[model samples]
Structures are given as structure tokens and as C-alpha cells.
Target: MEYTFDQAAALLNMGRNTLIRRLREEGMLGTDNLPTSRWRGRGVFRVITKMYRHPVAGYIHYGRTVITVKGLNAVSRKLRLAQHQPEGSRNRASWVN
Candidate 1:
């Protein structure tokens, strides 16, 4: 089942912000917390976009990212691996090559 970041963080025994920060540092997520193309996939995440009606704007699209069970596990494993690695190296953006 898909889980929101809050639920995933709880399951991973981490704070939501911390999880997001870690993902940012790993170049998996952008500053807005959306997954980068490299990590945005069926096994990792599902993005839901909702169109909200506005008084003057007519409609605006808002979205949220949910983690799959696989994604949660993936994140847990990545974080564990990261703990053993040195810092500064992983903070660079992982662009699509």
C-alpha cells in the first residue's frame, strides 16, 4: 500500500523532516520534496495531483507524494548505507545523465 511521508517516516522510525532532508542530501528529492526523475518510479513513489477550485483562479493544481512499501524499504536501506559513507560526497545533485 502507498503511504504518505508521515506514515513512511513513522514506519522507518524517523522524523518526516529528517527523512526529507536525507532524501534531499541524497539527491533523490528536490527542495520542494518532489522526487527527482532518477528515483521517481513505480517501486518508489506515486504522485497525486488534485485540482482545487479557486474563487478567482478557477482552478489550481496541488500535489502530494506517497511512498510505496518498496519505497519505504528502499529509503531505509539507503539511509543505512549512507550512515557508513563519508559526508560531503552525497550532497551533490544527481542529475540525469
Candidate 2:
């Protein structure tokens, strides 16, 4: 499944512009989650564009970037792990049990 930028931001509890900026700079969308090495190394979202013609105007093209469900799930899991760990702690698995 693919989610629009706005939908992804809403799901991640962040602003759309912030999400876009993070995606460009960090290659991830979620704010609370520390992006995994895999996510930080490469961009995840893909841009899709559509062209449409209106009665009053000529053809207009618009693009929307989308994120995959798997990507969102990975971010969500990382966020949950982050929330569970104590401050300055390194043991991510400590909170699993």
C-alpha cells in the first residue's frame, strides 16, 4: 500500500513540511523514531504524477510522493522501541520482554 505525504505525516504525528524535510535530509519520515541504518542510507518514498485537463484550463500536472506500508511499519516499530528504552540506554531488546 502507498500513502500520500499528508497521510504519512498524520500517521507519524508530524507536520507535512517537517516530514518532507526529514525525508530529504534523513531518508526517513517519523520524528520520534531513530531511523535504522537501512533507512538512513537511502530514500524510501517515490513520487507519482498525474496530468489532467480542465474545461477552463489546459493540461495540468501534479505530483504526489508516497510511502510504502512496510516502510511505515518499520518506522512505527522503531518508535515503539525508542519510547520503551530508558534515557541514554543502548539495550533495545531490554524492553521487548
Candidate 3:
């Protein structure tokens, strides 16, 4: 399905400009400002075919290490885990302090 800038931004949880930047940086989108047979309106709309890279970590599975693009869901999940678990607070208390 085709998505406008605002819709895409909301879906991706990113600023519209950031999405545009990615489209440009990655060369995943075009800026002809002209509509094609498939797309309507000017080039303001971007056509997303496939996710070349993950929205967040940008790294696919690599030897048990899931490196993702910054600001992606994976990073957010990790941050949440860290926040909940401070340090050395296992389920069972071991020996001395």
C-alpha cells in the first residue's frame, strides 16, 4: 500500500523529515516531483517496495547478535529492559551481600 509522508512517519514513529532523509540517503526513493502511472500526485509521495534495512538497528541476524538501526523498535525494547532491571537483582538472592 502507498502511504503519505505523515502516515509513513506515524507508522515508523519518526519525523516526516527524517523519513525523507532516509529515502534520499539510502536512494530508496525518488524526487522527480512528478507522478508516475502507479503513483499519484507529485514526487512528495515515496514508494516503499521492500525494507532494505531494518527501520531500527539496520543489522540483520549476525551470529546471535541482532544489531539494529538506531531509534528502531529493537533499541527501544533493549532500553526498556535496562530500565526495569537495574543490576544484580536476580530472581533468587545468592549468599552474602
Best-fitting candidate, measured by TM-score? Answer: 1
Our model 1 lands, by Cα RMSD against the true structure, at 10.1
Q: Return the clash pairs for model 1, or none.
A: none
Model 3, residue 85: C-alpha shift (Å): 29
**Model 1 local distance difference test score:** 0.73
Model 2: how far is 5 from its true place, Å?
A: 1.5
**Candidate 2 residue-wise lDDT, 2-91, digit = tens:** 667687778788787766676646545444333435564344455577889988888998755576655555544644422223234455
User: In order, what lDDT does every prediction score?
Assistant: 0.73, 0.56, 0.38
Task: Name the weakest run of 10 consecutive residues (lDDT summed) in model 3.
Answer: 62-71
By the lDDT metric, which is better: model 2 or model 3? 2
Q: 2 or 3, which is superior by TM-score?
A: 2
Which portions of model 3 miss their true places by more than 4 Å? 31-97
lDDT of 3 by residue, 1-97 (tens): 3345555455557786775566444443446422234423333243333334678889454211111222223222422322122135446343112
Best by lDDT: 1
Order candidates by TM-score, high to low.
Answer: 1, 2, 3
